[model samples]
Target: MNSVIDLLMNHRSIRKFKPEPLAPEQKKAILGAAQMASTSSNVQAYSIISVTDPLLKKELAEFAGNQAYVEQCGLFLVFCADLSRLRNVTENCGEIFHQNTESFLVASLDAALAAQNAAIAAESLGLGICYIGGIRNVPHKVSEALRLPELVYPVFGMCIGVPDQEPSLRPRLPMQAVVHENAYDTGAVLEGIQEYDETTRRYYRERTGGQTDLSWSRSMADKYRLPVRPHIKPFVESKGFKLD
Candidate 1:
């Protein structure tokens, strides 16, 4: 396979990092790669905040579900879905900005795309990276800590640095369970998942030294057994996303 496809296939989240920070030029190149990602309508509705302050990183670590990697990583970047810039541009042009759910979706997609590009670029450069979705666990506190303005919300955080540990790639759902032809085959989908669950169970058992007995569907069912991040809608609305 080509290098790019090989790199994509071998992707894994790196949690442990070496203490050394990335060089200035490396940071610049990674950010440039992120900026080159495709954005909807060329709005580029995203902003990245690189946190370097020790105290702030410590606080963010606590806020992000006590993930110590946040503070230990060589670089911590928070990707924000931002529409504030567009609002300001519209105001300067003597027009009102009316944002709806579509605007929010567009900005979110933009931020996700940009962050993925940055992650790929970092990985290509021999650096390891992990995406921190726990940053959304307490969105309000994160916004307050970061001093984010209205119409801008943190989508996720990323930790990047020299790798300190090697991890096996996580298994994904079978292609037949995910990809569909002209019409979705429900029967085939169910069978595929059932087959894939066995694969996931074996992986988990091996990874955990035979201490865990979990299948993919079982783990997912437990995760969604209760409501998750129910406060996100109100929090995003408060950030001026409206999402109406």
Candidate 2:
């Protein structure tokens, strides 16, 4: 087994996948690893829907910003932040069922922890995985496709399979910028981001065959310049999360 640092440092998101299926044992082991992750108060307030149906996968692919990897990967799992189970139990026991801000945080954390463990497990087993954050583009459609009830929100999707291409390892920010001693320093943080922008621009030039001269900071600033991308406030509010 590789050391934790090696496994983490060597991580790369695999977008190209081969047409191969994981063995039953492999699937079980990956799921088991996810199940072993720490949960808030042992509530285990998350659920994973292993998508196998081709039709459903196609729909999910469209829902996730037209990411074809959803249909190409051998296993596409949707991680959900779920409070429905607890709510049901509470109601069944003749109690008031109220899910507030704290409950949402616990569910979200539980889902994120489990998904990370599953990603590591898949990587260890010689399988490639990529996280599909595009699921949030149309969260309600995703919930509908998966038949998720109220109080259960789709966190993200993971596509796991044998990789067809080995992409370069993406660069990361320097540790000095992120690791603070006792207090937070805003000036250091901004400087780190500026340095990282240059690094990312170099990486983009190398990877995309000089297609873009885009720097990370410029790209992010441009994104925020549009109102549509920032329109997620209403969508998230509709899902019952109060960012306040």
Candidate 3:
């Protein structure tokens, strides 16, 4: 495989980190790479907030479901889906900025794309990184803590630092389950998942030293079994996103 494919394939979420800070140049390079990522309609509707204050990091760690890495890592970054800039720009041009579901989707997608590029860049630099989706667990509190303004919402956070541990790469679903030709094949999809479930079960068992007995489907079911972040809709609406 090519270097890019190899880098992508060997990716792992790093939770533990060394207590060292990234060099100033390294941070610049990574963030610069993030800015180089493709944006929707050249809007670049996103912003990255680096959290360095000890008290703020501690509070954010609590806000993000007590994920210690949020505070312990060398750097913690909050990626925001930002439409505030665009709103100001349009209003200054004497045009009403339409805040609709499509606009929100575009901003969110742009933020995600930029964050993925940053993640890949960090991995290439031999730094470990983990995404903290738990930032959404208490979205309102997080927004207040970060002082996020209207038309901007925290998408997720990332922890980057020197690796303290090496974990095995997690297994993904079989390709047949995800990819399709011109027409979709229901039978192939079902069969592929059934086969892939066993693979994931084995991976989970081995990874957790048999403490967890789970498969891909089972994990997904448990995750969706409850309403996760039911406050997200109201939170987004409060952020000036007309998600209707």
Question: What TM-score does each of the candidates earn?
Answer: 0.98, 0.91, 0.97
Candidate 1 lands at a TM-score of 0.98
The candidate that achieves the highest TM-score relative to the unseen native structure:
1
lDDT per residue as tens, model 1, 148-218: 99999999999999999999999888899998999999988998999889999999899999998788889
| Angstrom error at residue 219, model 3 | 1.1
| Model 2: CA > 4 A from native | 227-244
Using lDDT, give the best candidate's number.
1
Better of 2 and 3 by TM-score: 3
lDDT of 3 by residue, 1-244 (tens): 8998999898999999999999999899889999999999999999999999979999999999999999999999999999999999999999999888889999999999999999999999999999999999998888999999999999999999999999998887788888999989898899999988899889988988999878788988989999988999999998888986
Locate the minimum summed-lDDT window of 10 residues in model 2: 228-237
lDDT of all predictions, in order shown?
0.95, 0.87, 0.93
Residue pairs in collision within model 1: none
What RMSD does each model have against the real structure? Answer: 0.8, 2.2, 1.0
- Cα deviation in Å at residue 155, candidate 1? 0.4
- Candidate 1 global lDDT: 0.95
